[model samples]
Target: MIFESSHCPEDSRVETQFCQNLVAQANVDRAITPERSTSISPDSIRPKPSQAIQQIILFTPSRASNPQIQAALVKLQNQVAAELRSRGFTVQSVPTGLDSASAIAWINRRATPNTFALSLQTDAFLNPDARGTAAFFRAGDPQRQQQAEELVKRILRNVPTLVDRGARPDTETAFGRLPFVRQLSVPAIVLSVGFSTSPQDRNILLTRSSAIAQGIANGLAPRPVQARSTTQVPIRIRLNGELSENQGFILGGNAYLPIALLNGLAINFQRPKTAQLFT
Candidate 1:
């Protein structure tokens, strides 16, 4: 169930150092920047089924809470709350002090039988470079409930390992980088954010979104794939603009694949572009 980016760099000090540099640059860039609200515009996107959607916004406080950070937290919480409400989500916040048991108990109290839960680990600090944030959903019809469970398992399994191994604030990032150990019993999607320099990190975000889009479309519209439908095809795609030199697995349709077939597909894969393949 481990969904790893095929292109994630091997663990090395030099590679880590390069990643650290990128992290510093990104932070500096964001530091002087104004806060802008971003969401899937209603005109461009449709809503998911409310009955099928259960959401939990659990907040965990960091172990070290500075005044500046606390102020920023207030701002982010307000922004995130407003954004979720606009998307028709009923948001709930839990401020748990670095206590895993208390956090779990709070979430258990708040979680519903058929709802999507967004648990924010308050203990972890947000870093742009080593972290990623994203949302995930099912891709195809008959998307077994187990698929949702497995996705969480695959997606969250790596978080704690990295943190335990000293995941730096700036250098190691991805939404799925933090380890969360709650057993999800229903079909649910998680919107995760974290820092990462590797394409594997970004690609995971892209694929997770694609899955959510596909799932919503199928679940709301109920268009089943044919039994004999081709779920996967080996394609050679030619990268042009931004996707030309992306070093990672390519995701197409509902699959995450290696980059071998980039030249086979007719996608405009170029530098600064991403060429995702179907596995």
Candidate 2:
């Protein structure tokens, strides 16, 4: 999120405090979960336990000393820290120089598994003083890396264009062209709060990470894969009833399977509902 201010000094302070609070939340969430145990019969085999999902939060701010931005940034950061700590996340907030290359380099230093970094401008989106700003994620199966990429791509396609005298100009100057780089492995979705000028209203832009999560759960999107030869295969589908030359077969892709008949020979191959590109 990019925040615009009249003076740089007025906004630098908010950014610094925001970074500090995120660091504190990261430390608190790292504490170990309490253990509990129950014994099974000696003859019974032990069951494998499910592991917790780990996520890291990274924040990048261009100017760190501005007073107006710093106050807002720090208060917002502290609120974020408290919320994330209540949930389970290791949040690391880092304040760095405005140079895009250097800020990215600073982020690289704190990289971890399932890390999500948020780079925002000072005072980008000012939420109402009462509501406070927040991005909510619906907890479910962890979203895969490929699904995240596709959603992110769709989001980039949707970014509002900035126009200058009928000519489009770059809106994000500090992080010029950084969003397109795809080297980072873990999927990241950015939630930004900023001002919108169509009707001169305050708006929140949700990058749809949760919607991506749902699409992935339903297996509507394909996972990322390496390049491979486009080999075609002949598919021979079988139906239960006998076929006659005079009887024309109508194929319908949308059908719900009966759960009770699944255990029988009525249904065999498990296939996704989406249309297949290859036949």
Candidate 3:
């Protein structure tokens, strides 16, 4: 005989209750089980795994009127793009000679949350002595300011000979706002590698192009975030098996000991001067 409900016969209360419990358990099990499809289809529109991270858009000024400066900027731009790609970044090399508006439009079209844009260009000045590496970010943006600072730092570290012009706001530029730095939704910067007008700086850019590219790659490379523990682990110090008054602390898996605790260790060391510490 067919029952009205899918449960056990209602005539037997015990059997009905047991069936009800079973039904409830089965419903819960079905709810918790993850849904899976037997058939799978590939999505052509999905981006490859490698394209999802560390995407960089590299470009040079299309309005570089000076033939010499334009050539140098393009050469440097290509080198930087190659270097970044070698480091596993997805590099989009925007073609040279696109007008400012066109270039910005092209970049914004492809820019994602993970994308970073850099405009590589050479500075020009009538003084001819204006030479050095400078980076500009939008004014009042601390994040971009830090990024600019790091970029300059890495470039200087790679090529010590190049003078550090330091990171500045776009407001300091001849034109108040840099479209490349301000227009993009993603973080962007204008890197003036060196003054093409300066004889010394021009020579360095031409000769030390590889080192500069490596430096730019290094600066753009993502740094691993170090996890810091809120709980401080105290390390006990012992002098010849006797507990000493001074104690050390464990941080980032390393034990840091006080200088005073090293007195009886028979190790000779000089205290670092104030200037040395800062350096």
Candidate 4:
């Protein structure tokens, strides 16, 4: 989420803090579930596990001594951190670390399995005409590429004014190149939510900061489904290439053999070595 202040540092602190608080509030309102609370409906497919742990790295052009900017960043990351934690993800928010160190820290964290890094940034290009959102993802990886594209669709779904600048290759900037992109093994993306130079773009970022943050959390959260009562029914045994017509019964969630009817099926049956004791 990008936050800008047209009124110097004064508005920056208020707007930035507001944005963070909004994300936290929205997430709570959404009632995000921390567990993989999957309910198997009659028509539902097999349940999938929760989304993997993710890292959100929100940045600004780091100022060595800008207290307002730094404070806002801390608040922003904190709110987003709480939002993500409620959604069944082990999330870490890296606020104010904008250079090589931030990217390096991502490397150390993503070394563990099932981890990804996402960044939010604000831009004020010399060209005030610059507008819209831009994102960077792993250049050649298809799965990572799709994740990047999905982000754009989700983030800008409600904000119609913000143009979809498209996902780009992280190839040349502090984030686009080797230390950050090329050699970084984990999936990573840098999202320029909006350019501050353009009045229109700047307003979108400042006004919709929490909404944008919520949009991001929603995108990253596991797709939840309605739960259905699980009543154990007859168990079907598939042998060779076909399923059993009515091969077994389920009781106490376990399939049991009706030994008297076993000979009716063509399935081969044999006693195990342990069964010799009973014989």
Per-model RMSD to reference: 20.9, 19.5, 27.0, 18.9
Q: Per-residue lDDT of 117-136 in model 2, one digit per residue for the tens?
A: 54433233223221112121
Runs in model 2 with CA error above 4 Å?
1-53, 64-66, 96-99, 122-176, 179-185, 196-279
Give TM-scores for every candidate, taking all chains together and pairing residue i with residue i. 0.32, 0.33, 0.60, 0.54
Model 4: lDDT equals 0.54
> How much lDDT does candidate 1 score?
0.38
The Cα local distance difference test for each model comes to 0.38, 0.34, 0.70, 0.54
Model 4: CA > 4 A from native: 1-51, 54-76, 95-98, 106-110, 172-178, 227-279
Clashes per candidate, residues 3 or more apart or on different chains: 56, 15, 0, 3
lDDT of 1 by residue, 1-279 (tens): 112221123235564455556556545644564231122212221223335554645353442423433443434444455545555667676663545446545655666654544433222222334443333343221343343334334334433222212212111232222223223332333333332343444344333433332332232233335565454454443355444333443233444435444455655656444643333
Please give the ranking of all candidate structures by TM-score, highest first, separated by commas: 3, 4, 2, 1
Candidate 3 lDDT trough over 10 residues, lowest sum: 36-45
Instruction: Tell me how far the alpha carbon of residue 230 in candidate 1 is from the true structure, in angstroms, after superposition.
Output: 36
